[model samples]
Target: MSYSRRKFIQQSSRGVAGIGLLGTSALGVSLGAGSGHTEIEPGAFNFGVASGDPRQDRVIIWSHFQPAGQHSTPVQWQVALDEGMMDVVAEGIFVTTEARGNTIKVDVSGLLPGTTYFYQFRVEQAFSEVGRTRTAPEGDIDLARFAVISCSSYAHGYFNVYRILSERDDLDGVLHLGDYIYEYGQDEYDERSLRNERTLTPTHELISLTDYRRRYALYRLDADLQAVHRQHPFITVWDDHEFANDAFQDGAENHNEGEGEWRDRKAAARQAYFEWMPIRENRAGGISRTLRYGDLLELIMLDTRIEGRVAQPGGVDRQSEAQDFNRTLMGFEQEAWLQQQLSGTTARWKVIGQQVMMAQRYYIKLPDLFGGGASLWLDSWDGYAATRDRLLGHIRDHGIDNVVVLTGDVHSSFAADLSDNPYDANNYDRNSGIGSLAVEFVTPSITSPGFPPVLAETGAATIMAASPHIKYAELRQHGFILLTLNRDEARADWFYVADVLKRSTQYRLACSFLTRDKENRLVSV
Candidate 1:
């Protein structure tokens, strides 16, 4: 258990089971995922179910079984508040061995509290596909709703924005700001990778841990990303194509010296992303945490790619500052634990799920032939300009108003309004106040690929006609970003899906914005 790619429970690859078995109150785990339990067999529960980091009570259900016998496969679980599996609150049994490869995570706890549940898993006569999770607000909650999404590249097409966010039943969770899966190989996307008939299975690139668990079981056999993890609950984080592209805590730009080691391919992509993400591990912080939701919101997730990114900053001197107060994205101990959870939050929204683009991205101009000052993307946060000026100078020195920042890895879509001034394009009236403290929405790309439809609407009309706190930008879209928050406002709509390379694609709503709870600004509604 000495490995720690910024913790999320890799426990040196698994067989953990003993957080007192999710103790202190785990009250559910029984609804029927076992047709042969204690010795299961039949089709072992195909790769199609998940639940995630939620807590007011608990949540973390996941699966992947496959064992006709090499021993250990018991499986059996259930947690229901009714999806017609009768109210069965919780029941358990877990085995799926091979030192944790057959996968299965349970962690369900004493439910109740802004509740909503329904889980399933089995092994003998097959079951799975139940999901639907909730459970975060704890006391006198106001509102929280989410749905935010990010780079999803399975051979560059058709996830139909996870089937229109799995026909939303009004989400209360789902953040996922990372290239959820994409280590790149197979036809490496030319003919849209031969028009996805569910392709990509170690058809090349991943670099072992059995090629990132057979490319995460070919992207969990996408049935619209297993119906958005069977509808709801996902709060994830892992930008840098989940461990490669601009990766940094030591090296990446697609690793070199023949990739035989980049710390064992970033510890096999952090042990297959904590054995298939449901994220809940902090073994002394670094996955960078925080979550509260009740009196409005708090989230705060960040690891800034590899927990202390360092190699970006050099796309032809993107912002020169050599040693600019010692570059870092969230290094200095996660920037002093994100300025102590944004100056000890009181929760009326303070989100910050983290990945990139914390607005201040400059460098427009190609009209009249050339010249656009630096900043285009030295892997964003405008290449760590003193950690975006000490996190917008600690949210303008702790006067921290509503503060949002939910970004994603640039698959194009933005809304800005976090400032420290600078891109003044002749004072385009960003309310002359000089530096609004915070507001950023970002999200777009569950089907990755940005800027082609007329250079993403002409590079988003030259960065909103030269970034005066960029009100909004789309530059070719894919989808995801519902986001509501209450106790006086914090909207964000943006949907999209005109075609993820066609699977009857359709989703719409291309815009909406708002920001008033504490008002740092940004209003397009």
Candidate 2:
């Protein structure tokens, strides 16, 4: 059963009395004496509350407020130690206006490291659902667990995976590896949109600012998505669908000449994303940043979709064209930044959170009149061969140990070893984990479709058989990955849901793999 916010408020209201002052100190006073706002109202906080981008002392909390006939409104927010708004630790007032889509976000600072906090918002007599969040730890720590997820299309299916993850109490945070929301119109992406009772709000492709805002509001209205946001803090980075299909730095594949200017659409998409998401924005509008969790792990989030991607090469010679040194996926600036982060970090584990698979994947073809050979998937790292070579070669040369790559966007799950040349038998051993620079785990999509069942299973086998370094692949399931990091090893457990078409919590652990400390190869656990 889904745990609605209404039930949570009603259960916690017994200890509260009424509203308090605007800037309340850490006095541990109970708020909301007679507010009686147990349920959601039409014009106030209808999209729900969320928190993200956690650090040792701060985290960003967000919500949307739009009261009728008003262009702007002042909102009160409070953070406490308990579910009941009694043990107040921090409180403030922020103004939300029509220009920013009426979204409210406050970066609550002066927080204790590794502490869990419960927060609430208020406007006049209206109260929002209570939210729970945690700050990142400092110094040494033993273990940390995170849920890696991406690609949630509203028209595809119900958000059962989000609901299931929300029910869990052990996760430190959720790593959203992009595609938080899609830009497609009604019936554009999924044929079962009507059948699933899930429909897009704007009913057309997202081009303007309002269209993107409405699309985000539609996705956030789901009780499960709200529940997950209410339960745990999120660390997110956007992918192609967040803007459009196959989006690069300047334009996108789904974008056409009829849809006005690409720069305008891109700006609108970025504005709406910043307004809806709880991430901290930089002056240059770059989403690539580093997140550290004590001495245990340092998560380097990369923007592989829109920040600095060249248009992918096309036609039969695309593979050869991609080998050009000028072509880049993360741009030159981000690549330099990533190199500094990798070589300078002192954390036990270096984890990369980004979109797209990093391993080299190729499909073999039988010899024919045209002299058949393997074809590379240009959309992924295979398109930027030299770029990938530089990154992996750095790890191999610098001896960066326990480097793990967590990826999404393929709508499938895969476990593969990152090697300079997996096909070279003299250097790399398929059985003993030799000559491997790192390992990558590609997470499955939440609702986006994959190949048919027969093809998914058989094709996975074929790919693994051909690509000896790829140890595991599951294309038929839809779910997330639980990544646990400690001193000994970093383990990833693949969890799959029973169905996405219906609201169900039934799920199973499909497989498990781990790479020991100082060892780059994957071992089934």
Candidate 3:
């Protein structure tokens, strides 16, 4: 992949200049009464623009501007086919208001597929840095490539992985499985030295729209994060931390009665997410939508948090009727939509953008003194066993081939084969194969404790020995995955950064996985 930073800058400057001057009334509206500062600081452009929800001929563009004051203003946005500004493709006017924290989103459409375009925003005559984005390929496309990223926590460490990813020009876009922002309070879980020690915006818990906005602003300020947004389009889905820890359909692990109601917190999180993210309004359902890359791939981005999820329990066995087969990660409507899309689509591969592990994990027998029981994360698919089984059943019943589940939120890496029937003890036997439903690749955290010696010393080893479906697992590393998809196969190279505690961009390929010819079987590469 090749990228030209200079080209990006030159095009962005031109787009900014073309927007012309901002009207005084608009300026007054944006800066509020008595604030004379109209020109924004150079650093104000630090949080770059991003594009997402790509289609064959359209894509959504996003950016947030912190004007001088608490007012509203109209911003001009332009999309061009070339970085040279020779052919202006799509241009529009959007209003940024205090209601939406000065954030602007535009859904630009009507262009050729599988093409690159440059975009920029002009607020009050001030131009933002240019960004490059691409649309998905049209029908009958031969290939598509994307980078899969997950678990980026600011306090844990630097986003050097994001920086390197931003420089890659070969990818069509990026798939972020979630945990884009952590909700930990200041000094709670700092991975590196507490240099920029600051509490999350709300200062308390984020249970309101204002709180969510503040949190997003803090995350957007990260240099590497901004760079990645500027460099390529991203298809994102939120995991637990975006709202509160272990968020379910109705409540969250971080929420309490006195703090606020779960509904209010969830609403605030969703609102802030929509306002700040480069996601398209759920045209079909909600955040979960399908993006097609010709007939080669269909990326089904799922909303596991906000939909029909059951309440998360403190322990694995705490059962409730809500956690039954009727309960769902995606509501009934979404489940039906997904099934319809999958059944009707002609795409060679079905890639699900999921938030947690889908593969089943069980305990290995051990002495009582050695902690015989397994530790099932109540927040993951393991908690929704029936739902997982149903989805796998659908894959098998429909003969859906080449289903790949891209997941995050465990703070660990895993490569596994999804089985139609997990209860089958002889799943590996060729005669009793149980039919492969899918293949899943789980990415580790950007900076979180993974399989630390303490965890290992406890009983993880025994659990690992019992779980055969999990072909490979790695804990205690922070990085991203580079995925390249060609006609015949899809390959992922796990890139690991040396250290997130210090500012270092060093990375190496830790491992690789490949699935070939719609087999849905992951082979070590």
Q: Which numbered prediction scores highest in TM-score against the true structure?
A: 2
TM-score of each: 0.36, 0.90, 0.86
Q: Write candidate 2's Cα lDDT for 291-327 as tens digits.
A: 8999999999999888789988787767566666788
lDDT of each: 0.72, 0.83, 0.71
Candidate 1 lDDT over 415-491, as tens digits, reads 87877654653532475424567788998887766766777788888887777778889866778888888888889
- Better structure of 2 and 3 per TM-score: 2
In model 1, state the lDDT of residue 389. 77
Ranking by lDDT: 2, 1, 3
- By how many angstroms RMSD does model 2 differ from the true structure? 7.8
| lDDT-superior candidate, 2 or 3 | 2
- The C-alpha local distance difference test score for the whole of candidate 2 amounts to 0.83
- For candidate 3, the TM-score is 0.86
lDDT (C-alpha) at residue 99 in model 2: 79
Candidate 1 vs candidate 3: which has greater lDDT? 1
Lowest lDDT 10-residue stretch of candidate 2? 19-28
